[model samples]
Target: MRFFNTEGPNRADDHYSLPPLSRWDLDAILTLIEQKKYFLLHAPRQTGKTTCLLALMDYLNREGRYRAVYANLEGAQAYRENVDAAMAVIVTDIAASARVWLGDTDAPVLAREVLATTPHGSALSLFLAHWCQRIPQPMVLLLDEVDALVGDTLISLLRQLRAGYPQRPDAFPQALILCGVRDLRDYRIHASSEQAPITGGSAFNIKAKSLRLGDFDAEEVATLLHEHTAETGQAFTPEALARVWELTQGQPWLVNALAYEACFEQPEGRDRAQPIGVDLIDRAKETLILNRVTHLDQLTHKLREPRVRRIIEPMLGGTALGEAFEEDREYLVDLGLLRRDGAGGLVIANPIYREVLPRALASGPQDSLPQISPTWLNPDGSLNPDRLLDAFLAFWRQHGEPLLASAPYHEIAPHLVLMAFLHRVINGGGRLERAYAIGRGRMDLCLRDGAVTLGLALKVWRDGRPDPLTEGLTQLDAYLAGLGLDRGWLVIFDRRARQPPIEARTSSHETLSPAGRCIQVVRA
Candidate 1:
């Protein structure tokens, strides 16, 4: 039976998938290939770039217009700076793909022979030239994960392609498409022997255009869910369908993984008689996040990168990044970590990601938190806001300092530690939602347990900045009003150079907002 595929390129008969070609401008792509133009196709990992390339190769070969092959150069990554070894593997892989897809053995044999006799720098070019000469039709090559080859290997491959570009359609491949997670121009190839970094554009200036494969649109997402319904007679409730879209924002891997988990993994989900509902979808999303599934984990791992940190730190902390953050912002957007919201401001790509980022950042602190009794729960199992406040006050006074020191993102250490404490308190039976934006100067968190809801706003008083007490109270007032609550907490974190220690400063006092709503002010 066909299922949502999470592993690799989707096969029509084996997986429920959207049409690959429909995801891009097929006419524009064909025009590039027909014009013998070398170009690029890039998108975030697991977004189906490989699937689209495979489909395009199959289409071109079946149409008998071009002898097309899709070659994955990822295997050559192990050779790193060994240009000769990497190129040999890449050339052999391309030849093997050509023979498998086009059923032409002569091309592979001749190409391998040429690689054996050619110099290390010109080996790939000579092999491609020999292979193209043997083929009757013009060759179209899609080199997948081209950027995976680093240092001297990457430089050699790009240079070879450029060296052979002028002889296309007869001597070299008629057209070439390089596919990877980022644009070729974004690559900063560092060779061990070179003192300066070599940009990919300098190596391959012949690129005609860059095409990005996007995530599924709302309709496409719905169509994929509908395919499961059509096949199994089990329907997704309207809310569940919408929830999936909201959580995934049409990210292809996430859409498939969530559906697969809902319909197959959970025992309750496997019951065909039971229709999928929003609650089930929510559970699936929680499972995906907490377990740190491969895709989401891979994304969060990028948080440690300096470039990624510059863009993400400010978004998480609700402050503006430096003036030089534009390139980093664009880089994060290209990696699918950040997206341009309707207002053109950068935000986490989706609701799931919004939740994932902070939680992942706080995971270390959360794990280190000392055990505490559930003093916040009443006899009837409802959370008591006053009791929770007492627990947070005591916990913050005791462990907050050590925990903050352990947080990965230093700028938001206090916030991470607080969220970690709250996450521990609310783990099994409650929900915590976060909202923050660049220049907002605050992070708002809403915690819900059964019928009880609590709103807490967090702000930092950094060096050269005024105390955020008044601003936070006003912000908390609006936030509480939005949540339809008459009370909430405004937490001001003093981060000035000469501020008192956290233990000495940790305290809370009752205050009133400008709108006359009761507010609990926590100075930590």
Candidate 2:
């Protein structure tokens, strides 16, 4: 039976797949190859690029039009210091893959001989030239994880492929597909003895196009799940599917992760036969974020990359960076990190990602902190604005300094703390509605209990001011209007000055608004 493929490549008939090669835009890729165009296929890690390539290789070879071979160069990357060792590894891997594909181990004899005769500096190019001469039919070469190579090794591979580009159909690979996370322009290759970049584009200018393997579409996701249901006689509840769509937004890893967790890791009392629902998905999302695995951590690592931060930081601040947003927003969309919402605004792709992003970016002594439930100020289940604000003030008094001092994402510390506190309070008990976009105004959190709801707008004032109340009131008014609520609370942290020691006392009171909505302030 086929299991969820969280790691490694999926073979042709071994995995329960989305048609084995159903990633959208396959037609365009095949068209590019048929036209004898060399191109690049790029996508973030684990979005099924390898699976797509394997299926494509099968299709081409089965058609008997040309000899196609797909080899991943990642294994050779570890031998960076020795070019000969690296080249030999690449050749050995390629020969092994070629033999499996074409039933002939000697198919690349010319390629091997050229590498043997050419000097170290020019071996790669010479090998490609010789390989083209030996292969009778046109060749299609698919290089996976091509970006793992660094320095001279990477440049040599590109240069060799480029040198043999002119000898298509009769000799060199008719189409070469280079696959990696980012394009060649972003690569900065420095030779061991050289201080400056090795100029990658000069060696690999033959790229006719760059194609990204995108996340699954909504329909594609539904089809994949439905296929499993058809085989196992199980079903995902309609709400569960909607929740999956909402939380994952069709990112493949997330889709598979949520499904696997829901099926195998259900809470002790939950029913197994009934379809999983949205609430269960919400719970699964919480578990995934709180106890992050490697796949999620990898995306969080990109936050430090300027291209990612250029679009993310402003969102955290609730404002947009008009000029600094030069990176392709669509590329972020393709990577499944950001997406255009119904309002056409760019936000973190989905709720699971939204929750994980902040926690992942926050560095220092955090995960060790106890996960404590919020002490509700209201007796009846509804949040008392005055009491909730006071609770935060009290918590911040004791733990704020130490936590913020060690925090890596200090700029967003207050928001993270407040969210973490709120999550503890209402998590699994009631609903907490959170809506934040890049560079808007303030982070809005609505704590709900049946018909009653309490909204709090958390803002940071870096300016040298003792009070942000007046400025916060204006923003809170707009937020309340959007939420259709008459009254809410504002929690403003005065970061410009050192907060008074916990030994001092503070007061909480209700300030009435012109709209008759109640405003409470907790001065800590």
- Using lDDT as the measure, the top candidate is 1
TM-score of each: 0.97, 0.85
Lowest summed lDDT over 10 consecutive residues: which window, candidate 2?
363-372
Q: Candidate 1, clashing residue pairs? A: none
Q: Each prediction's Cα lDDT score?
A: 0.88, 0.71
Tens-digit lDDT string for candidate 2 (290-374)? 5677778887877876667777766876766677643456557656788777888788877877777766654343543454445
CA-only RMSD, every prediction: 1.6, 4.0
lDDT for model 2 comes to: 0.71
- The TM-score, computed over Cα atoms with residue i paired to residue i, of candidate 1 is 0.97
lDDT of 2 at 148: 80
Model 1, residue 191: what's the lDDT? 70
